[model samples]
Target: MASTRAWILKSRPTGMPDMGNFELREREQEALGEGRVRVENRWLSVDPYMRGRMNDVKSYVPPFEVGKPLEGGAVGKVIESRSPHFKEGDTVFHMYGWRDQAVGPAEKFNKVPPLGVSDEQWLGNLGLTGATAYFGLLRVAAAKEGDTVFVSAAAGAVGSAVVQIAKAKGMTVIGSAGGEEKCAWVREIGADAAIDYKAGPVVKGLMEAAPKGIDVYFDNVGGEHLDAAFATARNNARFAICGMIDAYNGAPQSFRYMARVIAARIQLKGFIYTDYLPEMGDFYRDMGGWVASGQVKSRETIHEGLEATPQAFLDLFTGGNTGKMLVRL
Candidate 1:
């Protein structure tokens, strides 16, 4: 029997998670039953939302159980297959992440199409990160051309995609990141203005960037960023509440400008990327065109080896990654 190394949740996190909360264990793989496929994961994704799963709470998704292997998005190659749906050496994307090897029903694995892009791109630009930006901006926020859009964490995977997609649609985009380097890259990626949130107050910077107020807001980091958006929003502004990475670690989020929600008539919608799975084909088509035309680009911070997965995930909270944070196994 073959052995596989996997990361198991040792305990639920109280605040920000640490290496002590996880345990790496090696286990023998079970027989590949009929209609099942075994995969060797090549790229594993570490997203901010995964942090919420570590807690024992009721949410849109079930919390991660202790003593079980953690799961997320992964792109792998079929090493063995007993199902007619897949063949040997096929590249597939599945939700059996955190483990170097995955074995499950063939239906859970989707074969990645040949789109002339790298395998990692499937986990970055063409994966859930890109999908979130697409639906959150264009569908949830209803952002349109000529709109002045504001996005938080603009150097991140979803936020970077939002900046580019908004710009491609002829919308004026203002992005906020942690540092000058990140802000510079945000501007280089077509943002009309990039605010360094770490330098000063977000509302102050946003006011200077767009004195006329913003028509749309794509929020990744909540709390202060959300408040800033509320303070500088024009009437009838649309807000897409994506991930609240700022308060994900059990931190309390206090918004003083929430009263503006009524005053500005702001339309705010919180969404999960899975909510629009029925329209994934639309996303692939449009995002594919933008990617091929060089209107959209992908950046990633990859940690080598499966052992580095925990640290990579921890890095997300510290702003250690400029774009998508992934583990290359």
Candidate 2:
């Protein structure tokens, strides 16, 4: 019999999450019931969206309950299967969370191809992060070739993908990152220009970078950046409201909410991938083909153990990673 190591949320976070909010506990593993498969979590994804889930607030997803192993997207190998379709040792993607193991029905997860460019890619460019970039940019924003694109947090996991994807689509892309190193990497990955958001007035830097206004804004960091996007957006420009990394770690600001869209005549839309899974098929197929053809470049930052899950999850809010942040056990 195997024991399960789990991280349970002890307290809700006020700003950035700390170790005090989570506690580790060990419990005996239960037998798999009919149609269930037991998973050994190999890689867990830490995302900015998680901060919202940590609080007892209402949003697109339900808040994580106190005293429970907080759940998020994870990919793992099936160690035991009661289901006929999934066999032992098959890898699957599921919302399993900050834990060492999980037992759930096969339908609760999606199986990934065993081998690839990298396992981390399955959680990044080819997984939820990739899907979000694909749909959010092309579908929601309706970005086209020749469109000038601006992406906030442009050196992170999803941003890395956006630069390449939009470039492949023939758009002129500019990215806003936090430092010179990140800015350089953004250019290395194909962004025409990369603005250092921490350098100064992002609006001024963006104005100097783009000059002609941006057609689409893929906003990962919101608040002041959103205000800036509204100020310089081209007429009829679209804004894809993804996770707001900026709002995750600080005092919440509610200004410029109405003006961002109304004054700019912007089309702003927020989405959850579960609502867009049917649309995900085309993205997966296209993104896979792109990966196969070497048209897209992806990066993933992996923390190496279950004990490291707390810091890994906390890093997303702090922008402590480049590319998709995941923990590899």
The model with the greatest TM-score is 1
lDDT of 1 at 204: 97
In terms of lDDT, the best-performing candidate is 1
Model 1, span 1-329: residue lDDT tens: 86999999999998999999999999998799999999999999999999999988899999999999999999999999999999999999999999999999999999997788889888878999999999999999999999999999999999999999999999999999999999999999999999999999999999999999999999999988998999999999999999999899978897899999998999999999899999999999999889888899988999999999999999999999998999998
What Cα-based lDDT does every candidate model obtain? 0.95, 0.85
Q: What is the TM-score of each candidate against the true structure?
A: 0.99, 0.95
Score candidate 2 by TM-score against the native: 0.95
- Displacement of residue 278 (Cα, Å) in model 1 is 1.2
Per-residue lDDT tens digits for candidate 2, residues 1-329, read 86889889899988788999999989899888999999998888888888888899898879999998888888888899999889988888888878989888889978886446666678888888888898889888999999999999999988888889999999999899988988898999999999988889888888898888999999888877787788789889999988787677675755564575676688889876666888777887789889988888877788999899989888776668888888988
TM-score of 1: 0.99
lDDT of model 1 at position 81:
98
